[model samples]
Target chain A: MLTLAQAQTIMSAALAHAGTAGFKPLAIAILDSRGAQKLFAAQDGTSLKRGEIALGKAHGAVAMGLGSRALHKVALERPYFVDAATHAVGGSLVPVPGGVLIRDASGALLGAIGISGDTSDNDEAAAVAGIAAAGLVSDTGA
Target chain B: MLTLAQAQTIMSAALAHAGTAGFKPLAIAILDSRGAQKLFAAQDGTSLKRGEIALGKAHGAVAMGLGSRALHKVALERPYFVDAATHAVGGSLVPVPGGVLIRDASGALLGAIGISGDTSDNDEAAAVAGIAAAGLVSDTGA
Candidate 1:
């Protein structure tokens, strides 16, 4: 399980990156091993719904055992799976940026990170930075 | 039944734990026995869909008498039930994170925790921390 401290570091780094990049962001969230939310930050100039989107994207990553990007690939391959789960989950399940699945070096499931605001790609970059700054690894380039 | 205080503590603990560990996340939700929202946190950076997903997961946890993970698996097996529920709720049946069924010892229903951000696993972990921090029991393992 990634420690809360680590999650904070990630979020901080993400925030810093966002600020440096002059990106528009609302909130950022980090989860633990079991896909639970650990930390949440709603930055200034961020709307409330941005937080929800980050969470939803992160949720999708955790549920599917992959990042939102990977989920997007799966959605392309099998939209039905995504759609079915989407319906079951109500209005959540966005396969876009701002979400990444966290895992250990040994392939253990750690958790996920979500970001909102900016473009989908920017959100994803922030999430990546947050996780990386935390010293934990994200299952990416897979 | 988990009191509102407990629910709030659960969320706090979960957030603390997430930061300590290392994750990126979004929002979280808590539901009571009647499937009503008791506490909700729309963390920063969550996606637009997180609130709904969290609600759906929590709804599934309470309605199906299981955690959102279990509900997710079941929904995967039976997409129709998920489909039916979506229409039933005017499109509010997220079986994703931001939702987890909360239960008490002796297998009694208390409520649920729905989380967004990070991955579903991360969301689940956050919920676990929140519940544990609150000294409440979560039936995610059940």
Candidate 2:
């Protein structure tokens, strides 16, 4: 069970990491294991659709049970599969690197975090940092 | 042009109002006038689909240029029109009272806010309170 406190910690730490790294404005989303949204925040200057993009990444990670980094590769190798999966998940699957799965020390899935507004690699790094700060493991599927 | 700060204020106040009024845990969504999501939050214990429902209310409101209260009436009187409008808005239209339009003192549309988890009337009340806290006017389309 990903408690709200843990979700809030992840969000705050993710934004903090982005600020320290001087990344572009970001939108972040956290979804629990069941793919229910837990927390979300979009920076002041984020583009209009960044929130949805961030959410898509996180929701896709949870829905497919794979980090978006892995999904990105699947998208390249099997475009049809990815496309069908996107529709399967109700069009919220964004195959990209910024979505990461959250796990406990026991490797139990807790939730996922997604970030947007910077390069995909940088966004993934921020998510990794946030999960580590919360003493959880991040599975980027790399 | 809803700034992040203002959006945050609305979220916080809306949640606060819900808490004080002893409403159920809620999911809230804010979207800018351009129909872009600005901020979103789902309280602890919110059901899995509450976030989407909240977003649909707000998105539907902005897309239709009317608050969800009006949309609700339309859904009753002109079901086909409401159904078509929902399809037009990428299936994010939820015709209900929980969606309200945000306007400036000058009567300019700014964005919309949606809340779910309580009675639709209570949800609309919370949205109105939040908008007022931000010194904006709320049009429930009553």
Candidate 3:
């Protein structure tokens, strides 16, 4: 289980990295392996839809059991497949980068973190930083 | 359509009201009449699912063309009806007091606002105050 405290830590570190890196105000979401929300936050200046985008990234990762970086490649290669998956997931799947799976040192999946409000690569970097801060491994599906 | 500025004003005022009233930390969501998100924010320390609950409240109100207050009554009078409505809305409908319709002074619908993280009545109060702060009318369906 992904503890709430751990989820908060991931969010804080992710936001901190975003601030330090001069990224746009971000929205972040953490979801446990079961696709339940663990924590979510949207910075003051985030656009209206950023929150959903963030949730989608994380939810898609957990639902498909693949980090969104891999999903992105699949989306390019098989748009219809990803489209069907999105429908299967209740339309919460966002096939893109910036969604990273969280795993313990034992390589057990714990949860995922999704970030929006910057380029996909930069968002993924922040997710990586946050997971590292919690002493967890990040799988960007690369 | 609800502008981002208006939505933020509503959220800030609602949060301020909650703070002054000693309510718990809140999660707020605003959806335009078209059911598109306008804003969402969850205070630190909120429970994991509060964000989705907030969104559900607002989305349900927008989907049904009535305040969640009325939906609550419908739920009590006919549970199965509310259940069907919930499914029809993709499971976002949350029939409760905290979901309110936003309208102009002339009674034209503009959007909806929903709040979670406190008693349902208290949540409704905050949503009302937020809409008023934005110079909009609130229809609680009471």
Candidate 4:
């Protein structure tokens, strides 16, 4: 189970990584296995909407059980599916690179992390850093 | 004004208070003055619905410019108003006792906080504790 402590750890690591890498202020969202928000934070100076956008990406990743990068690829071929997915949840499911699913060492789905603020690639990098820092697996862009 | 650091401090204090009080697992939501979510978290073992419900209560408190307790009173006096409120916001408002408006020392509305997963009274207690811990005011019930 993704405990709140673990979620906070992941967020801290992600923010630390972003800071060390000199990325812009970012927001991070973590959702549990059931796609409910476990923890979320928006760094000071991030856009006002960063928190919500980060949550949408995390929710989308958890809903699909895959990284948003994969969905981005799918969006290229089937954009309508992306739109339908967003409409179904009444949220903006950003099919971008920053949403990544988390898993245990044995590959059990735990939850997901979404990062936003800098470039999508940088955001994804920070998320991966956080997942690794927490000793969890990122089942995206493997 | 509410900053991200203050929001984190509030969540930490709320969770600690809940743990000490031995309340059920909880979900907390904090929203900025603009009705944007600033922070959110769900403790381990909380039902998946907790986060959403907490968010709804917070949103409702913000929309009505009062605490959930007041809204609850209003709900009792005017059921139709509650129904309209729930419908008008696409089902985000929850007129319950777990939501509390947050204010600065100057009596400025900073945001609102919501708690769910325990009895309404317990939830309100935790929210109030957190707000006080952050040196903010909960302009409801005190």
| Candidate that scores best on lDDT | 2
lDDT by residue (B48-116, candidate 1, tens digit) is 455666776777667767676665665667767766765665555555544666666666788988776
Candidate number with greatest DockQ: 4
lDDT per model vs. reference: 0.73, 0.92, 0.87, 0.88
**TM-score ranking, high to low:** 4, 2, 3, 1
Writing each residue's lDDT as its tens digit, candidate 4 over B31-128 gives 88877888898888888687889998899988879899988888899999999988987789888798999999989999999999999999999999
TM-score leader: 4
After superposing candidate 4, which stretches have Cα over 4 Å from the reference?
none
Q: Candidates 2 and 3: which is better by lDDT?
A: 2
Stretches of candidate 1 above 4 Å error? A1-71, A74-81, A84-142, B96-98
lDDT of 2 at B69: 98
Candidate achieving higher lDDT, 1 or 2: 2
Error of 3 at B91 (Å): 2.5
User: Better model by TM-score, 2 or 4?
Assistant: 4
Could you arrange the candidates by DockQ from highest to lowest?
A: 4, 2, 3, 1
lDDT of 4 at B25: 92
Give candidate 3 misplaced runs (Cα > 4 Å).
A1-54, A62-67, A73-91, A100-142
Q: Between candidates 1 and 4, name the one with more favorable DockQ.
A: 4
